[model samples]
Target: MRVFIRIFPLLATLTASFCVQAESLSARLADPLATEAMLPLRSASALAARVGERPCASELPASPLTPLDAVDLALCNHPQTREVWASARLQAAQVGVARSGWLPSLDGRAGVTRNFTDDSQLTQRNAALSLSWLLFDSGQRSANIDNARQLLDAALATRDATVQSLFLAALQTYYRAQATQAAVQAASDAERSARESLAAAELRYQVGIATPADRLQAQTAASQARLNTQRAEGDARNALGALANALGFPAQTPLQLAALPAVAAANEFQQDVDALIAAAQVRRPDLKAAEAQLRAADASIAVARAQGRPTLSLAAGPNWQRFEGETTRTGSIGLTLNVPIFTGFENTYRVRSAEAQLEARAAQRDRLRNQVALDVWQAYQSLTTATQTVQTSRDLLASAEQSERVALGRYKAGVGTVLDLLSAQSALASARVQRIQAELDWNIYRATLAQAMGALDYSLLQAAEGRP
Candidate 1:
């Protein structure tokens, strides 16, 4: 009874602590985190959503989507985003686990027993409570906390990297769809021009000014142009379906993309390759994640070493027993120093294993670091080439348009051959295809460069649409 009375207050306090902790855990697990809790969404709100935590109820707008809108849908619906977000949360919980090593533990046990003896029948009731508080562990707790924090950091970086990759993907599909649409328009124009040439050839032959071969050639060119138009239209449909799929929609989902700007805003991405690589080292999330993993591995080594060291702890136990109708009570409190005497060379091997893991992580980080630099360099060169190609294609297109116009006029006036007309139209069609492709490449490369630098975000999408 005395021991029970003495320990009552301690039991009440510990029980209250346990209750609070249970409530906290219940509240934390009651619901999935809202999309706003994600670290990546701070800079890229367009990608914000409760991706895996909840169903995406996003409805497509009736109006055509611009490039930014396409990117937003793709990122928000990416299942991988939620996977990393969950991983980060898991690591955060582990950090809590590490910090908990500094806290005390309380436990209670109760039992009843009946004995059959020749002298007397007896019943016993026993209840005991134990308390233990870790006072020192050679900094193992701190090291564990550091490791968990680093892992969390790595998870966050990984999430960001995943989002950026998705962003680039959405951008690619959007640009490709636009390019296909433009090609369809160019093909239709060619078909119209071919039909007009065929009409002029027929009139000239009827008037005895052209040969039958000339009209036949014009007829053949018209048929070919009409075939090209049908192929272009089919390609445009396929491209739209691909874009829809990229944005997390079914291939059969109808999607209308907004017309690309008459002039895609020329971005000045020109910079020294060295400067870009340096920027990637700082801004690249994957590289940051790798560095964090290395740091976590380093901390793990500390944790492993600390596990082998002695630890100091405070412990207390209180108990009460009733036997043969007589009450007995006891209580004890003390400090204990626990030294790891031997573990069959377990600790020794553990430390070595930790060191080896640290080395592996270091090697991986270095490899990734080099890869980051290479990615930035390659993206920069590609974008530079795309920029030049866009301008050149535009010039070639202008000249082709003029040449085709002059050829059509001469044929209409009966001075140019149908062969010349068809040749000029073919050249014009090729130039148009080149120009559309150049424009698409430029847009994709722009997004790629931003992704390679780990600087891709909603702002890049906004800039593409000329949105402030």
Candidate 2:
């Protein structure tokens, strides 16, 4: 009794604390407003900010897009593309800087200096303005200007090439994702068939009409089918990730590709391969860039040779001289003629180097032409093969569908073994997968051919219109 009494007050205090704490927790659980209010200031604000915020979807620009057009737009908007353009603009400025040498430049100077003599201090102030212009520097300035123009051309061509390649890569990724999705579906169907077969095998074994070994085989097959489905699902997810990344989306962002544009008909490939080659040579940007580089090199040679020659120019400018605490004085400018005695063989070497560069560029241009021809030919073959595969796969799918139907009918009539049913199921799944591959291949090849022909800027939809 004594001990009980002694512990009573302590227990009462503990109970009171517990009651208060419970009440506080219950209030928090019951009232979200109270709970939020009790949270740390920054944390609560963060939570509210997250909860009250709407998605930033409005930040995205609106545009009409086929896959290729979307890629073109992305390239245009990309930071790297903007930076490259900036570089080109800088090169343009450099050209202006080089051309400015042809005109006279004027400069002004003003300063005051103090000198201490043995016993006296002297202060002197003076201001003068003068101008200098290049009477002649051979043809260096002209050559530099020409080179800048060619560089601009090359930059533009490079930009175009990047755009084309990115467009093709996006198309390829999109089609690959579609193919993987198809494969996943095929895998799921296979899994379902295997499960059904396993059930049938079990029933037959129980009735002593099927061997235990058959039942085990069916079970193993079902397990393998499930594994295949898992693998296919993983592959499909990876493909989606790749496509989204290529399209310049966040890795976690969901992708929704619109229906593929109609494929070009087989009949349109009737144009001669040689004609296609000729078209590409004329239109391809890289070839144009190479040609421009060659011309620029030729201009450089001229500029170099001119560097060794004398230059004459007419120049006139007024100069002003000011003295502290005195009147300002002025003088008149006159014409100047300058002659280049020597540059220590610098100009000679430069000319020779420019000549060699020109020769190298000519060789490269020839190589580019050959490579373009080969690319066109390869693209043509791929397109032809893909179209034929699409046709063949379509027919195979139709036949496989019929075969599966017949096998299922026989099974229902108790006249088919599980083996027959399984075989037919496998065949149908393979056909579907093959058909998807064929379609994807066709799309890729078509895009490649368009790229090779320098027709990426053309409308894919228009190109495929009125074709089978």
The CA lDDT of each predicted structure is 0.85, 0.72
Model 2, residue 358: C-alpha shift (Å):
0.6
lDDT of 1 by residue, 1-468 (tens): 999999999999999999999998887775333222433443235354323422232557677988767876776666776677777777766777777787799999999999888898789999999999999999899999899889888988887888888888888888898988899999999999999999999999999999999999999999999999999999999999998888778988998888887655365778788999999999999999999999999999999999999999999999999998888999999999999999999999999999999999999999998999989888888888888888999999999999999999999898898889999999999999999888888888888999999998767766656765
In angstroms, how far off is 416's CA in candidate 1?
1.4
| True-vs-predicted CA distance for residue 69, candidate 2, Å | 6.9
- What TM-score against the true fold does each predicted structure earn? 0.88, 0.79
lDDT of 1: 0.85
Candidate 1 lands at a TM-score of 0.88
For residue 30, what is the lDDT in candidate 1? 52
* Cα-based lDDT at residue 162, candidate 2: 60
Q: How accurate locally is residue 27 in candidate 2, as Cα lDDT from 0 to 100?
A: 81
Q: Candidate 1: deviation at residue 3, Å?
A: 50
Q: How accurate locally is residue 186 in candidate 1, as Cα lDDT from 0 to 100?
A: 96
Please list all clashing residue pairs in model 2, or write none if there are none.
138-306
Worst lDDT run of 10 residues, candidate 2, spans: 39-48
Highest-scoring model, TM-score: 1
